[model samples]
Target: MHRRSFDRFNWQDVLREIPPSHIATRVSFFLAGFLMALWASLVPFVKSALGLDEGAFGAVLLSIGFGALVTMPLSGILIGRSGAKKVLAFAVPVASSLLVAAALVPAALPSTAAVVVILFCFGAFFGAIDVGMNIHSVVVEARSGRKLLSGFHALYSIGGVAGAGLMTLLQTAGLPGVGSACALSMLSAVVWLFAGRAMLPDAGRNAESDGHGGPKFVFPKGVVLFLGAVCFILFLVEGSILDWGALFLMDEKGAALEHAGMGFAIFSVAMTVMRFVGDRVIMSIGPKRTVVFGAAAAAFAFVLAVLSPNAWTAAAAFFLVGLGTANIVPIAFAATGEQKEMPMSLAMSAATTLGYAGLLTGPAAIGVLAEATSLSTAFLSEAVLLAAVAAAAALTSVFRKS
Candidate 1:
């Protein structure tokens, strides 16, 4: 009996028993966020060093989004063929190195065209890694039979904060842009090397075989489309907080220049904390109610922030917005993973692409609205959209089941 029991445990069983996939997924998410944040922190320096004007800089920035759009759909196919772990091992380092390359360009080459090309490539690799990591997260969550996506996303948020803070400290301590990028690149390499080994092998193998072995791209439709639409709204709200929250506080609420960032800071902190506890929230309340109530709360908070007379009240409202929007994306992704209409990889890829489109478009939309009407009006428009998201969430059967 003892021999038979010992014989039952195979290598796959061992791998399952010592499941490091979840930890590795979290690390990968963190690394991706860190690399992106580090690049963002160095953007001003890069622009100055390259001597690009606002128009030229904006054009360069658009290249990154263009590249991401080009590659995001293809990533699902790639992950389906090669698996998330293999794709990530190749993509993450390439993306990080490209970031270092972009930083070095301003110092050595200093060409706008070169910077654009490098950044485009960086965005391509980054987008691929993003899809790969999320696919991996789904696999891990499936195996664990628990809610882990929220916590994984929380690590990404934490990584963003840490990366931005550390890069700022390094620059303030007299490090050049290239030097800072180099340090971050090295750190990224170390983290990936350690974590890459533990990632689940062949993570999307079943997904690939689930009628997704085709040459064409699979776009989100049906329930996947609904979930993606919800994600789009949530991502738009998040982007608004990042890009316009500070401006809203400073311009509308009379916040000092030094205090301008407090709104976003509070939002980020609240969001991070809520995401850390989001799994429990989802388990207790279910995804449907969580998303519906969360969207309502976010819409109400946004209106409150827009109407608040003082900076402190606006910051409080922003904090509420954070808590309200924290888990919507995770829930959406979780639903995508379980949807029967398409392969998880393709569904998630399409959903992520739509969500990213909303994020990229949001600030520009707000700017247009603000220019035509007022910033307050622009925010009110977003609140209305959030309300629509809430309604959709309440009606969607996918959210009901997930």
Candidate 2:
């Protein structure tokens, strides 16, 4: 069993026999992750330059989310017409160029209006590429008949770490934030220029389109709807942890402000490692077992976190949550690719858009719940929802026999 699963991801074959299209898909995921993280690292510098207070800054940050919302649904339609590579090739340059443009805002105008618009475009491209690249991965995985989606997702995690670490090192070396941002964004553009060249020119255009009219954007339904609903809860879990876990540790568990960050850090590291191993694990156990067991584990971890007597134990619970929930969306994507409910690219877009809606709204929703009740209560609610996610995945048509 182990050898068979390992054969699915043989390192020797990957290094020497890998096709150019596969490489392009991998690079696309990595570049998207890296560029997004790079922009994230520049937020503080932009905030300072704009002279915005906390509330105002948070409002501005919404532009990024807004950008994503605007373009995400359109991505599927665009890909169906233009193909994933064309969509990616067009979006990547705009996205990467905007990274430097965002950094340069401080020197240029320092206007809130300009920053919001630029970041909006920045986010739009990011969301477009997010949909484009996943569609590309689906097509590539289908042709290869291998369980490569999780590994492809793993590259995004690796890219995120590299991006954040690079920004940190530059800051530690005393480089100015804006300068570092500009330089790194330039490097990203250069890297993409080379890596994107091998992308499949015709991927995502051959999905079950009824004719030359291609697939129109439809709301998620059937298996696609279940996948979207599952993605919503999972992305909610992720967003909550990223945005609120530190506060929960600090206030409820008595962690120092500086050390509270370790909660999310532990989650990120664990999730990254698990993603690297996820393809093999899914191969060994299959997606149904992976989702059922993984979401159950994460739900239990949330319960542990809620009941923990101290910050350290709660952090450990979060680590478990990360490990358990790592491969969920990849499995969902793979399943969606197989469904006949809609065109592969269109289903991906609808599900992805709904999933990101959870991320964008979840943190604020948690805040409202915490204010009305308590953070622990809010977290416990997420635990319940995660359990539901597990139930939903296990019972969904994609995993269940028709």
Candidate 3:
């Protein structure tokens, strides 16, 4: 599909047709972020109702990752056989409904098993849509012959910021967690229904039909594996910030508990700001330079974040980390979509699965490293890893001329 569409895209294509395509894919990314934020806001309420301690709650959180890991690899194959359009239309609505279910389950039953089952399903559907939307966006961006992936991703980041604040405001207005989840779910449902019509109907299907499709799955070998590893390392950096940044701020940097939350907030805002300009950055310098420079900057930011004297300084450092790390994933996915090692959809599946594996393991990996040594050491290791990523990006052939 992408190979055929990239011959040329004019103003007529951009003005008349591209809007709907971009809108369709953008809504999927935004819906994923928005619903996930709604779930994040409900965590405290769900934990209390489920009667779980911190350790047990942590264990239960693994269920979400487990579900995503199990299903993410399959989404690519499903899109290969069917199409991103159908998978997305189904997955997005189901994922939204499951977010509401995750919120309401504890209130209704309060069973750990029940909560686990509901959240697992939610994560499964979320993973499917996540892959589907990304694959779809890759196609759209390719057809447009412009650096549009970063802008599409910026909406996902913006959705995260907006959803969290919206949920808080809804709760402040006297809506319960269940109510807030329901409200957000409705909004996402509307987007899914409206956007389904505009998605590329054969985004993955043309490349995946009988006699032309490859094996059931494409092994992430050579360059695909190399790019997948880069994504993994980058996601590990992000997961570290999301899961442990506040603790580091509180324990090592002398931040108050209430104030420590600002670390991620600032980090997120910085990332969003960078991503808004990332399309321009990629357009200006190209993907290789973008990855090389961005990774190096993030490595330095991680080191500074750990070494800063005060929490405020560390917060600013983390903001830099977010800024530097913001566009790497989008850039990696774009490269993956163009690889010829395997079918585009299956290759995307493999890359996304590996990257998410980093998300699943990064927090626990940090916890283990911190237990054995210290949080500072754990974070410095991330810096070392980021440096490696920069070197790899510089040396690898995965990033082609854009």
Candidate 4:
């Protein structure tokens, strides 16, 4: 059925006729971020309800990463064969359902194993959707002949803020975690139904000139690997902020529990604002200098954040970190879309896989390091990693031309 549709499709006609295609892509990015943030906001409640210790909770959390790792490589293949729209159609709904199941796990499931399975399934679907939407975005950006990837990512950041903020408010207003999760899941489904209508149909069908006849596997090689490493560091920094930034403020900077979240809020706001203008920055400085200066800024900010004596100063430093890291991933993804060594889908898959691995493991790695040394030392280590990322970005030829 998809092949028949693909055969009858005309790319030029579609571009001319479907004016909402770009809006649809943005909405898809928003929905993906919204769902993930909603899930994140409910994590504490879930952990409390399950009565799990830190170790058990950590183990359960690992399931999501494991599932994503298992599924991310296959996403490129699926998109190559089936197109991003079909994959998203299947993946989004599955992910939504799994989120609902996770919300109900406290009451419905008797064991941690069941919750882990549900989270694993949720991660699998979520990972697939992540890659699919990105593949779709790359196609859309290419068709538009401009730099719009940063704006698309900015919407994701906005969605994350909105989703988590709204859910936190609702829960604070006395809604149960299960009810909040269900409501958000339904909202996401509705958005998907509408937005899926306007998505470019079979966007990934032409990924290869021969039409899905490319190699089965595409491991990162050469500049792609270097790009992936840069992505890994940036993503690890991002994940560290999400998971540990607040704890760092509270533990090391003498921030109250209520005020601890301010660090991430400052970081997030800075990131979102920077991303809104990132295309212009890239246009002015190009991706190479953008990455080089961005990494250096973030590393310096990390140093300042670590040395800060109070929460306010730390928040200020975090804001700088956010500004620095905001555009690196978008720039990298744009580079990935243009590279000629492999199919875009494969390159994107490899990069997303490695980057996500960093996001998944960064928090735990920091925790382990902190136990052995201190949080300050762990963060200093991150600053050193960012410096390495800067050096690597300076040396890589991929961004030099862009």
Candidate 5:
């Protein structure tokens, strides 16, 4: 948990202690990224297999979101009371199973109803895993007292890149739909099992029994709520990039099919690079200033992205947006953990759930609005959201002394 322990542990000690914990984080991140990719990759296959039109496909996608919404709050409670390791231990297998089942169902039954059911289960499992892994990351980062958190998150993004790229690659290579999905599922399951042993010991029972008195349920106080709102807005921007960036290029900018992914790819690469550099940035600038400046920069980036004429300018804008958003969520998580109004675990759960809602719903909300008006209008609206974050940052004086 500490830098000193890194060298002091014998090979066996390292294997028994550090390796599992580190591996857990890595596997969790990899699987999360893979799950996101599986959706994009399997969409065409799902459409074909289920004999669904775009409207029907949209309805199926809505089922996934609803399942996530249903499960996230419950998953938070489990992680709060039982600790991340236990929850994740269960979640990983369930999620992997769902992925495999979802892959199989289309071929076996090949119906819209079956795909919807499978996707709902997949969404629930993914939500649980998301919260559990993040809880673990927070605990580890706290013990180390350094800026490892952002780098840890970087791994999740790296996994996303790998997942999306691999899906595209396999599809191009002519892998069958079921085969590709099964391959990812098996890979994720193997990685998760191998990493399970290294998880940080669950302190939930110990904390509760020791009479420090954990909260009865998860909820955020005023400041935590403010921070949560900030997280929500920031993540909404990220969700937009992930889901809509390609569409924006293709539909509005006339980008070719092959080039559509470039917008998101640029955003992903820029975000990854910024996170690797985030530790020193936070240390030097401090969290408060970092959030303030980061929000401001991101707002500016969104404006540039919306206003830009050429695809090249838009791509560069996305990169800037990624750079601006790189550390804001990590900083918010750190702040949430430091808040004193409630049990850390409960408060964190609340913050995470609300923030994740932004990631889950924001894209669709944008899409709905875009349908009523224009995609550019939707993007400009997100720029407004970032500007709202900037105002909140100023009010929090997240840069001023706490």
Candidate 6:
């Protein structure tokens, strides 16, 4: 009976041939995703807890962006000097500390300055983890020679679903946002720490080569700039969902407080599931088609969301948005790695910096638009941005040499 069961799962035997550490590396990357999702998940709670208006909220979120921007450039330098293991071991705990600190800021200081300081800290630490983990993920993917990057990123989307669901549950139970925030922050820190020993030691080894190569840092050039723009668009879509998706449901769709979280939850699940299958999709359909079609679909989805007369249609739009966005960023990362003008590490770090900038600035940019017009108008802007990305994807093949 045992043999029969084991025989039914021959896939496990093939998977076992792959090094266990690579699997652990993937898991480590998964934890980093959790951190990103945790931050994204906390956006609504932070907005409500602070009772911020659009302008003020945008400004406050910018502090986190400022924090991340400051560290993203340094990520390659640090990873180069220290390696992914040491950098992650140090950075993850420090970042986790900041999460806990940010979560507790309401209790510590109710003033605007206090909020800025807390978010700034969160952004810096989160950026460090973001670059560090992706650096590690790229290295692991190279070693495996498989299309695992998208799947690795998918785990982050999954983390978003998990974090959002948990947050929703806690909110439903009447737990104060502050307590729930702190609890998750601390929980993620513990999870990263527990998984630390199992993680790879040389995940960012490419940083050394990048550091010694011609210029330590070079601005995006030619195709690199184009790819970065594509990344910017994709991250912007994600930022919209994170920062405003819930508000859209509540303000426009008139969803109940308990159910508002479903919008992002659906997006997160669709994105996560697609990412797991994304590698296969990319392998079969190719990156260009994936990006072109995905962006178009996403744009249409957002339009559906805006034009939809009912709440259920709005929900469906969010899912399509997630599905369309799932592979664009991963493909961009793959292109960054393939670029010859810069070392893989430095190029990736730069791409990450730019992409994260979009994340940092994108949400607040929407808020500013929302203040001037309305959330629906802001969403319309996102649809336009995504359509531009689809056009960019169609043109990407021309710059393949650079």
Worst ten in a row by lDDT for model 3 = 206-215
Residue pairs in steric clash, candidate 3? none
Q: List the residue pairs that clash in candidate 4.
A: none
TM-score versus the correct structure, for each prediction: 0.91, 0.93, 0.92, 0.89, 0.87, 0.80
Runs off by more than 4 Å, candidate 2? 1-14, 206-212, 400-402
After superposing candidate 5 on the true structure, give the runs of residues whose Cα lies further than 4 Å from its correct spot. Answer: 1-20, 167-175, 203-206, 209-216, 250-260, 368-373, 397-402
Query: In candidate 2, how many clashes are counted?
Result: 0
Residue 229's lDDT in candidate 5:
85
lDDT of 4 by residue, 319-395 (tens): 99999989999888878878888777777888888899889888889989999999989999999999887888887
RMSD of 3: 5.9
lDDT of 2 by residue, 174-289 (tens): 98877887788788778778878888877777545433677677888888988888888889999999999999999999999889999999998888899888988988888888
Comparing 2 and 5 on lDDT, the stronger one: 2
Judge candidate 4 at residue 136 and give its lDDT: 86
Residue pairs with colliding backbones in model 2 are none
Per-residue alpha-carbon lDDT of candidate 6 for residues 150-186, written as tens digits (9 for 90 to 100): 9888776666566767877888999876677667777
Prediction 4 global C-alpha lDDT? 0.86
Better of 5 and 6 by TM-score: 5
Better of 3 and 4 by TM-score: 3
Q: Model 3: per-residue lDDT, tens digit, 277-343?
A: 9999998998889988999999999899888999999999999999888999999999989988878
Tell me how far the alpha carbon of residue 318 in candidate 5 is from the true structure, in angstroms, after superposition.
1.3
Off by over 4 Å in 6: 1-3, 6-18, 36-61, 103-118, 163-194, 197-202, 206-214, 246-261, 367-377, 398-402
lDDT of 1 by residue, 1-402 (tens): 999988886988666765688779989989988988988887897899888898889888998887887898888887777678888888888888888888887879888888999999988988898888988898898788888888999999888988988887887999775688777887797789889988988875444354346545776789888888887888888888888988999999999999999988899899999999999999999989988898899899989998899999999999999999999998888888888888777888898888888889988899899999998899999899989989977776778756
- What candidate 4 gets wrong by more than 4 Å, as runs, is 1-18, 169-176, 206-213
